[model samples]
Target: MKLAYWMYAGPAHIGTLRIASSFKNVHAIMHAPLGDDYFNVMRSMLSRERNFTPVTTSVVDRNVLARGSQEKVVDNITRKDAEEHPDLIVLTPTCTSSILQEDLHNFVERAQLEAKSDVMLADVNHYRFNELQAADRTLHQIVQYYIEKARKKGELPEGKTEKPSVNIIGTSTLGFHNQHDCTELKRLMADLGIEVNTIIPEGASVSELKKMPRAWFNLVPYRELGLMAAVYLQEQFGTPYIDITPMGVVETARCIRKIQQVINEQGADVDYEDFINEQTLHVSQAAWFSRSIDCQNLTGKKAVVFGDNTHAAAVTKILAREMGIHVVWAGTYCKYDADWFREQVSEYCDEVLITDDHGEIGDAIARVEPSAIFGTQMERHVGKRLDIPCGVIASPIHVQNFPIGYKPFLGYEGTNQITDLIYNSFTLGMEDHLLEIFGGHDTKEVITKGISADSDLNWTKDGQAELNKIPGFVRGKVKRNTEKFARDRGFKEINAEVLYAAKEAVGA
Candidate 1:
């Protein structure tokens, strides 16, 4: 494996734990070492849950491994079942425990026979899958299990169809702005006369999961988490799903139209034209502000975006196509969806860097030197090192990313938030104008004259003019380097030849 300071996604078993902790009356039993249960911090600390997270670890310590046994798995499962009385118990092996060749399915079956709560084994192949894929596969398996249970109960031969309603299938624990996105989407759908049947893995119960097939369609917004489960529903229960992640004004409008089209296909007489118009006209101030002269100064400015697939694609679209910003660099750490990301951002991105390593991203940032950066916490650190402005837009984030305010990055409201973030991240208005006019705080001649007046270096007028041709951002650094070069040598003054010699010496 590769050594890295941070990871874009956790191990496969952590994905299963995320799904388990997201739901109510569901507990995850991890058969691994004591410290392997790091997901507890994400659920409790990141999500800021006051209640204890529903997860237990059957620590496989030296004593247990030396004895060639792991009786703690069953014991922990039984204890958690007795204490919590959860509706379901998800048993899984961690990345390290996968090497032990543990029969987790057999253990879950035995627990099912003994305990009142049902048991489901998340047989995640950690070597073949990662966090997003593992989470998707586990959720798909759980959905299949519930559908089979409904079939056994004679609910329907396959599944029952009902009125036009949508089941949101992507809200998970520690997702980027998940709770607010769910709330905004539900509000948008409700205003259009559509009812939300259930939102999976977020405040949803086992009973609600079984009712997933009753909805007219599924709303799978996130590209990383929920698309697999939606496809499973379509194959098993004839339920169609819409995969549209709304992030900016144009994308949010497209998502709304797609929802309307799906509802119409299901023989529903729904009209949201008035509501859409009203919301886009009055509620969406960001779109209106972009067209105004106040924001026109930001048009065609350069930006660099790096994040997960969903946010990266949406931000690229908004900045380049909608807001008239120039995208100097675009990339992501999500290698699973790299092809899709490239296809979506082909028009905007000149070069795409798809890897988990943050160093590559930092190199790209140094080369591009965009005015602003949109990325995660790691990119935030890189921007700080280079003195560039950055805003956190993706996951694997810090505690500050989880703000108490309702800052969603999903729909119309999210569009407003994005606009505000970009406005604040870059030099704007009179400040930008002044910096450009004054040569970034000091004119070239003034800086050179002041340096010569204070120091031993002397510059000819032509040399000073050539130095002034350099970009203002790096001009000061270049001048300092040139002075050091002259001082190091026996030269007492800096002319055009001296400046050119210094450039060669320092490899500027």
Candidate 2:
């Protein structure tokens, strides 16, 4: 295995934990080392959860390994069932414990024989799947298990809701803006005279999974996590699902139309044209702002987009189609959804990258030098080093991305928030030109101090003087480019000649 300082997605067990912790009175028991228990701390810190993270680790120390792991696993499972009284206990294995090749399913069976609560093994191969895949599969597994159990007990419903209703799937704890997005979705549904039956896996009980068929249809907002469950529901119960993520004004209108069409197909009478028009006219300012002079300034401005599949594809379409920004390239780390992501963004981006390697993503950004970046936290670091303004659109994010304000990345309000993000993320060409000509006070300081202190190469006085002529906002990029150019050519120092040569080579 390779060492990764940062990863686009965590191991498979973390995904299982995310799903288990998302629900009420559902606990997860991970059979692994103590270090693997960090998920609880991360969830508590990032999500600011009021309650304790509903997960436990069956610590696999050297002593346990010398003996066997099954006893410890069974003990933890039974203890959690008794002490926590959870509705369901998800038993999973981490990358470390999977090497032991112990029978985790057998352990679950043993625990279930003694425990009051239901226990199931999250049967995902950590070697084959990553975080997003594991989360999606785990959710599907839980839904299937609960639904089948209810069917066996004759508790499953056989009818849809009397009114138009939908089940919002794939929202869970620690998701990117899930709380705000769910709120906006509810508001949108309420305004359109639609009823929300249930939002799955987030503040939901395991018992509610069997009642999911009550909704007229399902709204799977995220492609990464809920599409599998929706597909399963459609195949089994004939419940149609709308998987369109309404991130921009144009897509939001389309999503509304899709919802109306689905509800009408289910023999319900609902017209959403007035609701759409009203929302576009008053509730959402994105459509209006896109036509304004300020947005016009960004008509042809270039940007690079990279993140998870859902947000990356949605934001790319928004930038290219709605905001009139030129998306130089787009990509995602969700390789499982790469084909779908590429198809979604084909018209917008000429180039599409599908890899989890942050180094490759950083190289691409450096090569393209797009004015703005809409990506995850990794791209945020790349943007800082390259002096490109960036707005985070996906996970692998920092705490600041989870703002206190109502910043939803879905529905009508999301369009407004995204428009603001795009507008503020671009360093306007005109402003840079003016700053260059006016010679800002910070330019000299930046040129002298340089962008990165880790650089070993020295810069000549002549090179520093020449860099000061460039705009202060872009001086860091220029310096980095020059240093890279010099380093490539085996130059010990960056001088005036080296700077000019680097500029010409980069077509700056």
Candidate 3:
């Protein structure tokens, strides 16, 4: 059996719901059993984040299952939310709801009529759909509902722009990266004197979303939202869009100038590199540090990546190009234009794995015997059993207090963090000891020689020599903190001791 995944396309999205729950003016009505909604809360709790925004959810039960109770269910929901008068009510049907072939649209329409509340419909087909679909469906429904509502109310949602602002789509749940990408885009748009309408599925509220049509344009940082919203807007509001994502500095620069061109053909092309450098101020320092540390040690370290399409592509790009690490197998539980990614990474590996199931990815990783892995909780277990070092890059991430747009592995600083984690995972005794004692200390050579002074400590010359073979360019500049354990810190620097520590760490 394979675990399923997908890339989302719309506003009534779980990703948007996930991020929006943290902001005001957001309401997501999960049409699932109570537990499904609770599971979301559980994920947030595990991540130690107050990320999921609380939305009124109507639990569809066995009784609702046995009979076609769409109207009754909608009535109950409307009454509950009508008291507070929610600006927008998101009607999300679960996998169970989808199974029953419930008329979710009709149900929402009835609910809207029954109460004065504006309604948005999200069709979450469980058997066939995953979080990505939920997000896509949600975004679509929210955008459509808002557009119509705005027309009826004669209220155009316009920002400061006298001409027209742009909406950043595909941000909520469509298998997109939240680690600073959104923040970077926001900053970029602001710098351009363009008031971004809102990040759909993240900052845009049901009320605010209703007026989405007024925005002159839409900007999708990722693909799913961009293409889908573009289609919907063309048919409905007739709003146009540009498929643009600001990833690396080059891409960011090209995109900024492209946007300028789209808005005004004669628009002055500004220096995009300057904008990027100003926004990601720490990028230079992080890059210098990452390049100085044990990045060389990570070379030929095989990797297996399983995440969203966009992130997987991003990870492999950085791993192969930036760190000189090898990605043996990479895949996304996401669907998109694989061609773009295929071209960039095809030469790096013999085979590129892309799928929406864990069994397939798990099997692939198991067979490849990679040195490290980057995925989620399940992949961590896979890496553990297979004797590989796995860094969690996807969800079931229980760390919530970590700020958004704070990918330690992104840009320069993030690159440094990635290198450190990788090096730390593979580091062995005496050489590891040397890295510790003198990597950052004032005495440098003296500290390292002193730490390795115990000739009878039983450190392997071969391992130390092999460690030296790693390229200096690949190593991060930041020194490993080894001063504490410099002088025979209780533990011996023998192969057996270090090996034991490594094994115990992963329970291998």
Candidate 4:
């Protein structure tokens, strides 16, 4: 059996908190003294909200953490929450209370009664814990407790007079690194005449929480949250869900087919192949760009991937066959799907290294000595030490995927971006070689060895013959500035006393 762990589900665009906050029925009561790193964690995790102010809160002081300041914790717990008094109040802890072993469970219980709130409290603390487990525990607790209570009250969420829709679960926590994928998936689904009734931690509101029954099935590409959320949706609404990463041509089309099957069974006549065909154009554009022979010299590029398992799988598979890159080492710091990753690795690479932690990944990269790496921000530290260029793929993620859909990672444009960024890094290193060869000073000693401050400057006939060979990033900056150099002024084109005066004007 493939053992899958539950990764923490939220902290995604953190739009889940926002979605909850908007409902007036949601209050995020954090169980930590004010000294907790709320600002930094919130800053690092979510993008949409700055303060998380109206919806998010923590027990007010730092002293409460180590010393268990119950009085202060209770005082801070008093909430005049602006919504429908919240049918459910989610309690999460910061590192302080989590470490101090404070009685947050009782604190929440008493607070509910004292405040006379009709809401239920849930503990969602997952920091300093593994990702999937973090999200899994919280979600399982919520779903099971909700189900048991509803059974007692004879009010099951799925006991409904509903139509049909597919739920897109697992957004907030795990796959939150790159939201463009989710956005593109949504757009693609809509263009194909599919309705996504709920996208948990993103579009799924508490009001819609019970409406999850309306969803005939679940579509999850982010495996961690998908499996856990699928279990929840199945138990509560008896909804069966498919867990798959909607990446690559085959995987993407397969997902559409699975949803189409579910929809057809539910009586929705949709052309799944046509939808996949329409979407193939988006994926194909990137295939053409990335698989182009311009990179034939770079074919069989050796690479090591270390980051989220999902992202590692995606990049390694397509990158290997499409871009002709070879994956020598593959690993992950976050909890993820290894079986799925292994399947891709087996095809794309000769050897695949998998890990659930960072240290092991660093060790693997040092051993493999691959030419390039795609990794988490933390792994970049290791890459820099090893003199390798590592692009951040997962956590400590880069903000380059901004404005969502404007990033083409989902469709053809995304593949193009990948090819462009990777190719430019190496091909652009040729400038120095060209300059050293043509710009005089042969015999390898004067040119490649070292040039003194007093060394006279000279560009041979071959050098002057190639005046404007600069490319890309620094091209415009150098184009306008190069001629201003004294050495350029002394050339035959502008031979003047001003040339000598210009060189003397500044000691270069």
Which candidate ranks first by TM-score, i.e. highest? Answer: 2
Residues 363-400 of candidate 1 have per-residue lDDT tens digits of 67766667788898988877655556788888876777
Q: Residue 307 lDDT in model 3?
A: 65
1 against 4, candidate with superior TM-score = 1
Question: What does candidate 2's lDDT look like per residue over 1-508, in tens digits?
Answer: 4334779888888898999889889988888888788987788678866785457888999989899988888999888888988888999999888999998889989999999999999989999999889999999999999999999999999899899999999998878898899999999899888898889899999988999989999999998889889999999999999999988988899999999999899898888898889999999999999999999988998899999999999999999998899998999999877789989998998799999988788878877778899999988887777777799999975777667889999999999899889898885434655755776434455522222245778879997788877775677678877888898999999889999999999897
TM per candidate:
0.85, 0.93, 0.69, 0.71
Backbone clashes counted, model 2: 0
Candidate 3 residue lDDT tens string, 234-322? 67766667764454433444566677666664233345556556644554343444466467666677776676555566666666766
RMSD of 4: 11.2
Tell me model 1's lDDT, rounded to 2 decimals: 0.79
Candidate 3 lDDT (Cα, 0 to 1): 0.55
The 10-residue segment of model 3 with minimum total lDDT is: 474-483
- Candidate with more favorable, higher lDDT: 1 or 3: 1
Model 2: residues with Cα > 4 Å off, grouped in runs: 1-3, 428-457, 480-491, 497-508
Candidate 2 residue pairs that clash = none
